[model samples]
Target: MADLVFTVFTSLDSYIEKPGGVFAPPPWSDEVGEAWSNAALARAQHLIYGRVNFEFNKGFWSAAETDPNSIAAGIDYAPKMNALPKTVMSRTLTGDPGWNGRIAGPDIAAEVARLKRDVTGGDIFAFSGAGAAETLFGADLVDEFWLMITPQLFGDGKPLFREGRPESTMRLVECRPLDVGSVILRYRRASEG
Candidate 1:
């Protein structure tokens, strides 16, 4: 069975996004970009996203296709990222996402389950922060988590785990320190769970 993984970049305080819609940019550097490209994006065969993130990524990345070296693309692997198939989970989105993407139905867990079975990709990845990740985690659908912890912290911001999700235990696969004091943590749900 294809495994569902949540790969996200978060602050030391566990915030995914800044509070109040203010952009709290991660400490992104060339080294960090290359590391992400080589480590996560390169291995991914397919990607899944929450509705808002899907739309945002499509617009942002699609426009930078012609200029792979542009700041917006931010990596040498733009083409690969653009080509990967994506499924966007949305209840309100009715049509195609213009890019090589699909709109998943309202039942997020069931749809993800179907994808896990049917996807020929080596692994299915979701970078949905807390929105879809919470739902998937709650349903026990996520098999692994790949979190890149930035060195900085935001005292109050959008958290990676929300208020009411059930607790889950994970087994650490490895923790690697990257450039500029960032760390990438790989963990899988305990087998006995």
Candidate 2:
């Protein structure tokens, strides 16, 4: 079975986005981007997202794949990202999701659980989908977490985890610091360790 990995880029204080709904810019040096791309390519076989993030990523990365002027175009990231299969978890979103994507059925947890059972050997990544992450985390379906934390802190913003979440233990698997002062932390469910 595949591991369901909840991955996010956050500020030092664990905010996934700044106060104005804007994301904190990723600390991307060429070396950092390369390493990130390599790791992404090595592990992820499927991608999951919330409606908002799904649309944003589709627009951004689709353009980045062909637009030489795009910041991410120079890196190997864009094409790989665009090529992956994506599932968008949204009840309100109708019709085609575009960009090699599909709308997940009403039951978020069930869909993810099905993916976990079917997709063998690789990881199913929940990328920047706060709601989806929370749902999967709550369902006890999340097997790993990959958090990339930038050096700066957002005093207040959207947090990765909210109040009243179930308690669970994690074992640190890797901690790598980037040249840009960002750190990538990987954790697996403690039972798996």
The models' CA-based lDDT, in order, is 0.79, 0.83
Give the per-residue lDDT of model 2 (tens digit) for 1-193. 8888887888999898888787677878886766665786679889998888998888888987678898668656678788888889887889888998999998877898888888766889887566766776777777888888899889998888887667889999999999999999999988895
Q: Which consecutive 10 residues in model 1 have the weakest lDDT in total?
A: 20-29
Error at 89, model 1, angstroms: 1.2
Name the TM-score of candidate 1.
0.89
RMSD of each: 2.2, 1.8
Worst 10 residues of 2 by lDDT: 32-41
Clashing residue pair totals per candidate (backbone < 3 A):
0, 0
Off by over 4 Å in 1: 66-69, 72-74
